[model samples]
Target chain A: MIKKGDTIPGIFSVLFGVLILAYIKTNEKMVVMSADTYGGIGPGFFPFVCAVALVICGVLLVLRGIKQNGNVDYFQLTPERKENLKSVVMLAALVFIMLLAWKVSKMFFLCLPIYVFAVNKLLKRSWLFTILFTVGMTLFIYLLFRVGFHIRFRP
Target chain B: MSFELLMSAFLDLLTPSVFLYMSIGIILGTAIGALPGLSATMGVALVTPITFWLDKVDGFAMLMGLWNSAVFAGGITAILINTPGTPASITQAWDGYPMYKRGEGGLALGINVIFSFVGGMISILLLILLAQPIADFTIKFGPAEYALVALFGMTMMIAVSNGKVVKGLMLGFLGLGLSTVGLDPVTGLKRFTFGNMGLQSGIAFIPVMIGLLGLGEVFYQMYDYNKKRAAEELEARKINQSLGRVIPTGKEMKKWMPRNIIVGLAATVIGAIPAAGGDISAIICWGNSKRFSKDGENYGHGSAEGLSVSSTANNGVIGGAMCTMLTLGIPGDAVTAVLLGSLMMYGMTPGHTMFTEQLDFTAQIMVLMVLANILFLIIGLATAKISAKLLNMSQPTVWAAVGVLCIVGSYCISNSYMDVIIMFIMGILGFFLKIYDFPSGPLVLGLLLGGMIEKNVRTALIISQGDWGYFVQRPISLVLLILIGASFLFPVVQGILKKKKAPAAE
Candidate 1:
């Protein structure tokens, strides 16, 4: 009955803290204290303290995660929750595709409207309304960013 | 406080362009605040990046107008529907919806608009009177005291986290740790930059803010929308939309005015506390007013006085929050955290300098705050009837629009694609944080104040020749540490007392 929600962040923090500790150890320049330093404390001191605190807190979270019997089991995906997950994945994919398209073409004006159109379609809007919305939103963004701010999308 | 400077500020804000921006912000705030899923903090976060392109006065006028009106407009949905438009309006729903059920929708709406304005103006007057004294006192603070102030601000994470103190502290520490990704403050040595040019300057605050507040909320709403739709609870409710009289009689107003003034003053005090914003203030005020009122029996059923107190308290926090942020460089809540970041973007630092070097700008802001409340009062009253139409906006449309804005807004900050990617990553992380019931406010406060806390602490260390005793040796720092300890311990003691009282009550 352990909550995956609590456990995952706990483990993540512990690993993250360990990673920081490992990275700082490999770099001699990132010392917590140096004899020649003005304050006798080096750049790594604050982050080092944070890392240790993170590890300690992470351990506490893991213990709490194991002890608490939460209502929702993160590992078990209900049908509606699955649909919710899919919608988010689709949304993230849409944005990623827009970014990739903009990178390849550098034509934000063209890419933006198409991105909007795709998003509206994903949201299950009528085709006609989606087209109109895409056009209206694109023009609004264009007029605001391009005409008003005079920001050039392309070099 | 001089006449010339005051007149200059008035002249600056009296321009048509400034008024226009303020009007647009008011309009947007009304729509945003009347919608169930959207929040004032999210609206402010979304608009903040766009404001960077405008003049300081125009930009702040828009922000001030948006913030004040959004808090006020939340009552629109609270009265019309049982659901609150924003967290601040939660208490508004108690008496407001029931009053609407009794066909007093217009009266409830009227009370909300009038009392919110009154509360907002009262808080503004307090801000004007008190901010200078606080700033002058804090001007003499040493680095240790300043560091303690930042630490004290971070402890607000516990308050905002809504009983998840450990998780809040963890995320706060995560923010503080992430803040050290760039150059070391004391030494010029770089810490976590894997040699990327972007990492040299560190993670940008705006993009992360936009991601967490904007995209994060959208994603969660999408998920929640799906759940609601699945449950078939999306069916439109049939309620009386007919609004009766729009204004209360003078006799009625006189009856409620004293109680409302007391509640507004109390809310102002609560709002000045770090992390205690409109939502918390309103709840405290509403509960306390009910406990003391002669008509306490009618509180939840349908008391106009209760609605007035709730409405007054929520907007009353604005002036108090601004006072803290402007004078102490501490954000009372998420919106002010974003505002603090925006101020930094404008090449202005808050705190003592805001009164000295930036006094003109500060005066302009004060004038704008007063102007914003007046503007919203006129507009909110005029548009109260039409506000119900705002709730009809499609959830999908809002989600898509907010999502695009989040992506584009982050990119608009220096036209960096890297920022967009960072925003996306943070969006996913923020979604998870929300799913797990973690409060994003503390995370944001930590991110915004992390550098201040670290920089001040290190500087104090240097001043004390690396002696840790410096913090305790200073009177102000010692006092702040005691306050911090009390802040953490109070909740624990309260929880223990509640546990002890529960069994006895049962």
Candidate 2:
């Protein structure tokens, strides 16, 4: 079982590197001149420095991981553990269905039943309770965001 | 600080809309916290869109409620299934799961809930009373001071990583670098977008959070799911029957009351500091409880004190984090980062002027925190047993639902399909990172702090006429710098001293 303690920093380093490279590429003009005095360096200067520092840190991390025998093994998914994959999928489906219902038909209330049914079927929960929970949640969202705040359902 | 202003602020917060928003927060917090792999940060991020249309007070109130309740409720899943709902609750599962196996799950959860409530409420009270003074003190800090504060926050990762100073610093700098993505805040130039449109805005914080915390867990779970189970595993894993009564005995409560209060207070104070959060508080408290307890050996075997200490410390941080955000305009955690964004969306920028100018808004959020705590206690107790049944569900069904939620959450953020793609990519990256030994907290922290660090550095330097001396000249900045320096060196020095003392003691 991969623990949280095992995996966060590596992904962060790569992502940080990607971000730095991206920033440097996008704002080319900002890098060239110290036009404004946000500091002794131009506005781009701090971010550029921060980015370089981040890359150095990332390189060190990858090296450390290699030294510790860390690699793709941390990312491997075993078959038995795949049973729990349904949780993430179910949550994603719920959101997709809700958004689809609301977006296509503007029938925000329709999403409530789907939510209830999904929760019920997935948890093997009591139908009565699931229904109540679904309805309660739907109504709460409606009343709070739609009715009270007067937000329009995205069309 | 005027009486009239305070009265009006109180009135603004007491309105029915604020209560309604707070209620929504509590309910959402409980649901998200009760689920395994779902974290409070993700919950807040997903819910932020709902608040986009709300009034400033109502939106802030809701986020606050969610923040407090989510941290407390995370223990529910940990106690029941040995799976922590949030990173902060991971330590709780150490003792909590053992207690569950010993058939004291209900009692453990009950104790955890009560202590969490007490811890959260006390912290809120502290925030309400001390916010102005703290803000006033913190406001004295300038750019150099903020940089120092950021440095101090980064250095604390040493304590967090458990003596792994090199790894912690590596991770912290990595986070700081990731934050540098997107167009420079002051100069409008991009640093590292790599010709990708999505990269133009830099890396989105929500995607990183969802990927690292949420998807990363999924990958780990998949690995565990592949492991073959012993025949007895099914029987051993069956949940224990409820103990009927929810509350602990009066004697038991009385014995732990003083300790609980002390733990709660200490946790709150620590939590108020930026980058330090519930996870750190809970672990620190749990460690301290073991160190001090006469029955320390029983800690992982169903000790009520252990549960109380961990839960209290975790929940206590919510209010403390809020104090930093409302008073000093610095969000202490991811949830508050979303809240800060919401505040910006509502055209309400939090600062010294916010207290004097937007007193009502500030008061409303404070009141909502108190109300949310009460609601969380009531709802949490009532739903404890029932919520645990989620663990029994078939795997496929649950995955389908979560998949839907991820899609919806991503799409809702900007009403853009591109964001969904970004979310998916992040999720994959997060999964891979989890397989490798890396910390995601610093990455998230970097993403959250990156823009602010850039914007502030520029503003501060401009004001100082491009003089570096200005940063050192300010009293507040000088103090913060010293503190940052101390934080960085403390662990290294301590480790060396320990190494030297070890041979002498031997």
Candidate 3:
């Protein structure tokens, strides 16, 4: 029977499998045979097998999805769902900004408090509490990793 | 086994400085285990550098205490939150969290500590008494056998799928595929790196695990949060401010002790197998105990015995892992692998000679393990109630804290920002997987075991000149193959029998 919410994941799986298979075909380094070692099967054999199996499973999932009678819009969201999505997006955005800052400026310590304060604020903490918590958290990380553990954070 | 050596080792460990170091390790390890992204392995690794500055007895004792205590304390967080503190404590979340939800948090923590103590002591005893035999047995495992061991681990995917077999298999294969992204172990050729330098080393395990189990839980809480539910939780916490009996009744212990002992023994065996670690042991022991336990129906829902089995299995591996390291000069798991380096740094080589030539040192290690277990048991029991206070914190506080911890922990693994990116992606994937009713355990297991399986399988095939029949020819491989078959089939058979009995009863 066709199942609701199965179509997208199934399609994603199929596309993923196809992408791997296509990569193997185009990459000259993806060798299927080599006389170098004892195992006759080369590096490509295992991935090839995995990709084929994945594709088969994806096809089965797609078939099952199609056979289902009921379907709903995947993007439809209730108020609660919308709220939940907002929280997830907010948290993810803060994390992304922290990483992006590290990648660009190599000043992870500078972005640490910003990320922490933003998250605390997102969680609806009082402004004073968020500011203090952010400072305390940043200090804790610095002391724990940089000072105690002797971790060098140079890029 | 010499009384004089044992006495000497015990006396050495009794020294104030050594004991103080071990106590510090216990407290430090508890904190490490309670933190979502910090694991026993990482803790041990981080402390290894510090150990270099200390005397051998003091250093080894600290490591022993930290390792055992860390494994024991993972159950604390698993009970408090629905996330495992370490991968080894994953099964603990299945039952311990549910038990906490049902207000048996105190008892769950008690069982977690008690059984962890029992398991650790039994494993050390086995290490002391049967190290040679166990090592001898495991050392015979060739490439085919190792491959089969990995396969055997994967069979648990079915049991862990939460009855969604297709989704589980799909995720499991996806993990396997993802694992193949790095350089090909056999040929040194990259498969799926897409020319990215970071992709050259496969997806990092800890980051993905932290994302899936730790951050994913946070997202799930956010997704399911509602004001009414939050209010209800707050009310419940207020009413349950005091932790009820932290000790199990005598009868409860009597019933679960035997099962815990069996799981401990099984975990010891699994741990002695190279490449298998506490996570594998815990999963196998927890799954098997559920299948055979009379309280099987209540396993994932909040069975005390299930939590005990998981807690015990994870720590029980310590001694077994040491057995292999001491007797065969082979690292049984990653922690032992680090210990192996430490052992060599002390001008000691592991092998059969270690039992005789380094008899005093060996006895010291065994004694250290016992003392570590006892130390943590006392600390864990005394603090069980206090640790449960974590549940009283506001949900948002935990959410923000865990989110930041996840990022910091992932970044610390190798000081790589790429790991953070990987964790973020996996966190989103994990959230989606949960929404779609997909089980994440199988995926984790697959990724954990994929490299081992592929490397061993290829090595075995090459050794056999591509004759697959060579796998069945070895006794160990043959037995493992049978076990693998049985692991997959037993559930089906059990289901069929249950159906038959249901009809008859009707």
Candidate 4:
């Protein structure tokens, strides 16, 4: 069976290389200025060098990936692996909820509790415990940040 | 440098508000560390903004408290559950979880706490006494030396990548490239902004960190959801048994103390080196302890010696990392890098000069670390038994909680909608990466150190009038270069030697 890890790096290396090349091409006008008094190097110099290094390293990685032959199937996305997809969706939805809460009302203290509740329900935990945890966490955050520190949670 | 000034500085750090904040930090730190996937770095980064309005020493103390406590608490989850709380605690799980399964969870936790405290205290003393001298030595580094340091750090990525060297290097380079996306420091011109104003500041470390480490793991956890059903069914069928009394006996303590102290000292020294972190120290110490074990076969079983060595080494890195950050402006890991940024933001540049200029703030942070370590032991021992119950919680519920925290943490970083979006996308990417066996640790480390490496290299070159020889001319830089070369080559060399020796032994 192919391992998922080997394939991930191969894809990342290729994507990283493309990104580096694109960055260099788009920012070609930027150039390093000769060093002067008061201590500063031109902005373009470091980026250019860094980009080239990335491209080189990335290429070497891709080549190595191609040469490796054993258990490459580990990286494959099978139906069995599809179940793991829920984590991604749930995480994305949570981020969306948080953003909506932040934007809609800074006082959306509902956001945290809803999140905690959803998790508790998913974990097949008792409603009582979930509610208690949600309330406890929300109150803790509210007291600590808003009441104690006087921080405003602006949208 | 004056005695009166030092006294005043010490007095300032002892204020009631500072103590309160430190206490709060320890409590929060332990809570977060006890949770799997919530790390010290995340806790500190998330809480750092709260200190913006406080005096510098108070702010520093709160951060120190969190950093010190979080490192120790990470092992609590690992010991109780088979799940490692942080990457640093993974080694602890090799033996700790087995002990927990054998109904020795309490003893394992107690030993872990005591050794963690001892390790942290020793490292802090080392920091207080040796930081200035180390700083003086580090000042000699030039651009080439920084490049070497980055190189050395990159090599460690292979170790963290879990047997994939190429992928680790690729991720590291990718991170370095990402660091170049903002305005260049020398010319003040944009490099890879692509016309977006947000890119002007480069990828925000806080958001990227949250996405990669926090959200990414959540995504990976989702894959196990179905299998979780089987696990739940199995759990239902199994009888729930209470763990017996959880304290270590004197005989057990006597058996493990000498090994713990030796491993702790070794780990402290390793962690104190710039660029090396707790994860590396813990893993190394664990490996060394196993090699030196009288009953090596007992390892990966419920060996108290195994748990003690790993936890002590991991916690030891906190104080050691801080020493480098305070004295040399060189952060040992991502969290300290953020702390370093906070220090600079407060107009306190760390270096040999910081000792003379901000004696009290420095002393206060050190003292806070020492106190926090003691407090963490107390808190950890008290809460270990209760927290272990979390291991029995349903997987779905754990995921739900993690998902919520991930979103909340990302949003809290900037309170911006765009940041949440970024976090979501990054989290998805991180999930895919994890599934494919790509190590996020190297990538995070790369991004964390990328800016430092670039800016320092450019600055050193600028100062040297473009003389590459400047790095080699310094003794410290030369030593660092050799070390970097050894870090990269030693593994390969050792593998070869091991192979050759195997035939001879046979």
Candidate 5:
């Protein structure tokens, strides 16, 4: 009774599992050492098992999804689906910017207020409260960590 | 526990900073609970990271306080405006709203606050008394037994998955696979560091947790913006919030005391069971109490007895949930799942070690839970009228603040930008998981237990020279294995029965 969407996550799982298995095979550290010894399960053994399980489940899921897909149209882009996609896309952009600010410039503090306030702005909060919240929160977090807790932030 | 240690734990809560944080948590919990869309889980999840910088004891005190008060706050709207602020408070609407319609809203609300306090108190007492014995029992467990214990936990994900057992298994296994990304626990060999220095220590689970529960929820919340808009409009209209009488008379309290005791005990037992959330505890308790009530037919119609049972049982869940989380290393419910993560962050594994070594801290948690209920009553009643103003803050504003906190909190842990990147990626992954209707509880539980399971399996294998029979040779391990098989089998059998039922219904 697996639906069509069930296969989508399963496909990703299959791809991920394959990549891990490939890496396990190629990696030097994962090799079984002292095979003559009793109970000498190597580091890769557990992950190897996990990968096999993943692949098996993935294949089962994909087959189930395919069989189920025949009974019902599974690719319909309902409004809820569109909204879900849009939410992820917008969040991704915000995250990418936040990451770049952290990595490229290390301006976590500067990016902090803008990133937070901008999301609020997008959500249609009053400009003044959003700004106040941004500034107040930035200072509070800064002092709470850097001053109160002695944890330093990135420059 | 020694009287001195118990007293010391009480004294620990008296510190100005700890008291302040507890007050803040109660205030926040009340606000979150009073708002229809906001929930205690979201309040706890959002506020969890802020406690990262606080001392461990302070952090738990704040969290426990928040947990208690947020739950109590949900009934406020039910009595005042015929709406339950949290799902657990839906029972409040049945009796409380009816009373409000009859101008006995004050009496109903007062009953709610008093009974909730009693329920929370009883639960903490049970948690305090039972946690040590449970830990003592689990202390004798071996690696093979632990492996079975973890397998048993994974099976529980099916029970708790809210009918999406397949998706639960898929994500739970995914979490286990992801947990193996660092050095192998058995061989000390790197498995999936992927050449990144940060990956050697393993994916910081705290960041992954924040990503999934915190930022992940924000993304999902934003997904159905249109629905949220309509909900917000409805919220704006339901602003007839005012507290009339916030405390119950002694005679009224005495009247419900006997029934409250019965409901409270039942609630704790039910809460100890995985997948039985606060809502279920309230429902079951209320349903059971119907036979004992004099006005049984008026059970849902302004019956103070109805308010008493529901309020008591929901809070009673807190103690049972904590006991399981602390003593068994298994989360009692979703919030305790996060609480389990918090225990990990504080370097305290939720098992026998807590009793043998961190017994004082364990005792402190028990005492603090009791105190949280007391303070929640005090602060909640004091601000009962004003706490409703919490919804005055717009939804978008709250979401925006949560978004910022998620990013910042991810970065604050270990001060690693790489963790931030990891968190962001996981946040996106978590969003999809949510959109597709997968449970986050199992994934988090799986991640917590994955390493334990792997280490135990390997150790057990090494001890018995890779004999598959080793897992069942010991009595404890045999019992655990049987339990594991039963757990996995139960769902499949239940599914078959359900299929048969569906066909007959058609």
Candidate 6:
């Protein structure tokens, strides 16, 4: 049976599978045909088969979801569901911001601890502990990576 | 298998560095493993480079200890916070967390630690006894057999998943599809790089894993500040008047020992497969044990039997994984993949020769596994209080910090920012998977086995000059195919029987 939860995912998965299959068909590199290989099967063969299978599965799920959705309205979101949606959206945005900061600064030492502390603080942790934990962990990671393993982080 | 093997193994254990490095690994492994967003795989991957500078024995001892102990420690979070540190510890959350809620936090942790040791010891013994014979038998294995066996392993995981079989299959097949995005194994041509240099080598599962399990959990828990779990954890901490018994009573121990052995054996067998580990082992064994136990209905509530099975399966898996890695060149899981890479770096190739030529080194690793289990037992017991209390700490701070570690761990894989980006994408994907009730285990396992399946299929085809019959013509492959057919049919038959039985019971 289809529910709101399954419906979106079903559509997404189906579209994704279709797009991948289409890409594989168009990309000549994926299809390797030679006189000296694999039971007439090429690299693209397995992937192509997998994509079609995934699409079929996805279509089944979509049909099930649609049938279920026809009986039940999912427009009303409970507070808990709303909160979950909010939390996921906010985290996604936060990570996007973190990525931008990293790309701009190229300094984990500077950006990582700041966001770590800020996130913890936003979640209602004590400022002093958040700051201390953030700094301590950042230093530990820096030392462990930079000095211990001799891995160089981009400046 | 012999006294001499045992004697030499014990002799290899005599070195102080073996104990010293292992102790260091245990402490680090326990800490990382107890934390959400960090796992045994991450711990091993991070320390692998560091181990290169040390002596071979010390380095390997450290790695082995790190693996076993980290797996054991995942249950700490599972028990304390109802948040599993790894998927391997999910059952611990199922039963152990409930026990903690009933003010048996210490007892839960104790059972987890003790049974984990039990599992480890039992598996190690099996490793010593069976590794050689299994390797010898598999020496005659061909590409067709390998292909069938690997396929069998993946489907077995899906069939045993405590979820909708179709959902598990979908995710698994999708994961296999995703795995083919990189350069074609047989053709040496890029398949789905799409002009990105980073895409050529394919996505490293470690980063993707950290994002999915670790960061995804953090994001999911960000809702309502995870106040519900944090409140329960803190309340459990305050309500405990006594730490209770970290060691089970002798009678209690005797009661569980037999069942634990069965779970341990089952786990060990599963663990020997290159594509399986504690996650699948724990799930299957735990499910089986629950069904047989008198208090089967009490399983998910607060049954010690359920916790014991889960706990035992965790470390019980390591010895089996090591058996496969040492005997076969193939990895047993992501962690063993790292180990295999290390072995290759040392100019050692695993095969029939590894048993004969590298016998000493293999013995050394076995001894190290045995010692590590002992050391962790002592260490885990001593620090159970501190670890149990870790969940009582501020949730915001712990999880927020874990998020950062996830980022850093992904980046540390190859010191690439691209890896971090991949982690984010994977994190989002994993978040959705969880939200949609798709099992992540199958996907991860699929990615691990996908390469083997592709390589073996192409190799067999190439060798047979495009003969479709090559797969079934060989005896081993034929037998393996029958087994694969059985696996797919088993679930359907069971479902039919279950449906038939329900009405009769009514």
Sliding window of 10 residues with minimal summed lDDT for model 2 chain B: B226-235
What TM-score number comes out for model 3? 0.75
C-alpha DockQ of every model:
0.61, 0.30, 0.56, 0.44, 0.50, 0.51
Write candidate 6's Cα lDDT for B208-249 as tens digits: 677776677667666434456657767755544445667778
All candidates' chain B TM-scores are: 0.97, 0.85, 0.66, 0.83, 0.92, 0.81
The stretch of ten residues in a row with the least summed lDDT in candidate 1 chain B is B230-239
Better of 1 and 4 by DockQ: 1
Going through the candidates in order, the fraction of native interface contacts each one reproduces equals 0.58, 0.52, 0.65, 0.59, 0.51, 0.61
Better of 1 and 6 by DockQ: 1
Per-residue error (Å), model 6, residue B7: 5.2
lDDT score, candidate 2: 0.67
lDDT (Cα atoms) of all candidates against the true structure: 0.85, 0.67, 0.78, 0.69, 0.77, 0.78
- Give per-residue CA lDDT, model 3, range B77-194, as digits (tens): 7877676878888899899888888778888889889999999998998898897565456667788987777676566554544455667677768877787889899778877877
Global fold similarity of model 5 (TM-score): 0.91
Winner of 5 and 6 under TM-score: 5
Chain A TM-score per model, please list them: 0.87, 0.65, 0.86, 0.71, 0.82, 0.80
TM-score evaluated only on chain B, model 1:
0.97
lDDT of 4 at B373: 80
Number of the top lDDT candidate:
1
Candidate 2 lDDT tens digits, A32-104: 3364444557655655666566566666655665565544354344554454556546644554565556667
Native contacts kept (model 5): 0.51
Is 3 or 6 the stronger prediction by DockQ? Answer: 3
* lDDT of model 3, residue B420: 77
Better of 1 and 3 by lDDT: 1
lDDT, candidate 4, B338-390, per-residue tens? 78756765768676667766766676667677777866777767876666554
Query: Can you tell me the CAPRI class of model 4?
Result: acceptable
